[model samples]
Target: MIEQDRALYRPLWTVSFDEAVTLVRAGIAAAMRHQVKDLLVDTTALRGFPSPGTFQRFLMAVEWAEEASGRIRLAMVALGEMIHAQKFGVTVAFNRGLVNNVFTTELEALAWLDVEPGKGSPTRRQ
Candidate 1:
C-alpha cells in the first residue's frame, strides 16, 4: 500500500480471494483511520479467471467495509478482461451509494481519484 498526495494506493499482486478481501478492507480501514477520503485499489493482476462467484467475494468485502467505505472515494484498477463487461463490481458498489469507480490502469484510477502522484507524502502512516 502506498499513500500519496491525495489518496492511498493499494496494488494487489495475484492475491487470492481471501487476501483480496482482507487487503481491500484494510485499505478502507486505513483511509478512514487517517481521515483520508480517497482510495485506489489496483487489481490489474486478476485477469482471465472467469468466475461469477468473484463478484460475491467483492460484495462481501464491500459489505464488511460498509461503514467506512461510504465515506471514501474508491477507485479500482483492473484489466478489461478481468472487469466484467456487465454487472461489474464497481457499478454495484456505486448503486449501493458508495462513491467509487473502476478503470483499466493506475493512471486512470489516479486521475479518477484526482490524485496527483508524487505531489504529496508517499509515506504510509502507521
Candidate 2:
C-alpha cells in the first residue's frame, strides 16, 4: 500500500484472503480521510487464492466507499491469484458494472484514470 499525491496506490496487499478484507477496509478509511479522488489497487501481487467471502467483503467495502464518495475513482488490476478471485461465483455475479471504472493493463489503467474514459480510448473513440 502506497500513498502518493493524495492518491492511494496499492501495488500488493496480501496472500491471505482474510487479510485482504482488512487491507481493503484500511484503504477505504485512508481514502475517506484524505478525500482522495483516485484510488489505484493493483492485485497483480496477490499470491494465494481468495475465497468467495473475501471477494464479497472486498466488493462490499468498495461499494460502501464509492457510495460515501462518488468522486473517488477506483482502478483495479487483476492478475494471477487475484484473477482467480474474479472467476469466483459471487465475483462473477456482482462484478459487472460495479463501477463506471476502467479495466485494463497496469499502464492502461493509469492512463484511463489520467484521462476521462470514452473520451479518447477505443471505447470512446468510436
Candidate 3:
C-alpha cells in the first residue's frame, strides 16, 4: 500500500514495498504526475531488501522515466537502524542521476531534504 501525505505541503510518500517492483513503479509514476521534485519516501515496511538486479532495474526505470530538466532529490527512510547502513549503500551505488539518501528517521530525512541546494521549503510545518 502507498499513501501520499501533503500534510506539511510537501509530498511525503509512505509506501509498503511488499511488492517492491509494482509499488515502486507506481510511486514514481505518481510522483511524476504530481511533479514532485523533492520527495521523502518511507520504506520501513518492506519485507526484505531488494536484490542487486532489482535495484538496477529500478535505477534504469528512474533514468528512463524521470524528466530530464530538473533534479529530483529523494530521502528514503529505511526499515530500521540495522538495515539502514546496508540500504544506504544500495542507494549510493544505484543513485545514477538523483540525489538519494537513506535515513533512519523522518526528522533526519526531512532535514536533509530541506538543505538540498536550490531546494527551498516546499512544505512548512504548522
Candidate 4:
C-alpha cells in the first residue's frame, strides 16, 4: 500500500491484478467519500503475465474506475523489463476510456494528471 499526506494528496496503493480489482473498488468508495479528484496508479513494478483470473480482476478495476467520476486519473508506470511495450500498448488501447490518461514517465504522468511534483502523487506509466 502507498501512503501520502491527506492534506496535500490522496493515498495510492500498489497491487497485482489479483488485488487490483478490490483496490479499485475500495478506491472508488474512498474517492466518493473523500471527494478525491486525482488518483495515480503506479504499474512500474508490475511484472509477469497475469493469470486469467488476475486479468479479469484488472479489467474489472479499469471498468469500475471508468464508470466512476472522470476526475480520477490513473498513472501507470511500466518499469524496464517488467512489462513489454506491446502488451502495455494493447492494454492502453483497451482501457483508453477507462483512465483519464497514461504515460511512460512519472513526470509526464503527473503532468497529464495535473499533479504537482513533491506533493506525494508520484506514479509512472508505460
lDDT of 4 by residue, 28-109 (tens): 5565466555555555554334533435635664665554544444554445454344444335423544444445566675
Q: Give the alpha carbon lDDT tens digit for every residue of 1-126 in model 3.
A: 223522122223443333554554455556656766666666555555443345554554354234322345555565564243345343443344455556678898777766745453322121
What's the CA error at residue 42 for candidate 1, in Å?
1.3
Which candidate has the top score in TM-score?
1
- Decoy 4 TM-score against native: 0.48
Query: RMSD of each candidate?
Result: 7.8, 5.5, 7.2, 7.2
Off by over 4 Å in 3: 1-18, 48-70, 81-95, 118-126
| Per-residue lDDT over 1-126 for candidate 1, one digit per residue giving the tens place of the 0 to 100 score | 446534655554665666666666777777777777777777665533344376574674366348554677777776676556553565566656566666677877776667543233221111
Query: lDDT per prediction?
Result: 0.60, 0.50, 0.49, 0.47
* TM-score of structure candidate 3: 0.54
Residue 126, model 3, lDDT: 16
Clashes of each: 0, 0, 0, 4
By TM-score rank, best first, the candidates go: 1, 2, 3, 4
Model 1 lowest lDDT segment of ten? 117-126
The C-alpha stretches of model 1 lying farther than 4 A from their native spots are: 1-5, 12-14, 45-58, 64-69, 115-126
Query: Tens-digit lDDT track for model 2 on 37-110?
Result: 66666656655655346556456545544443544555556554333433342233224332223243667667
Best by lDDT: 1
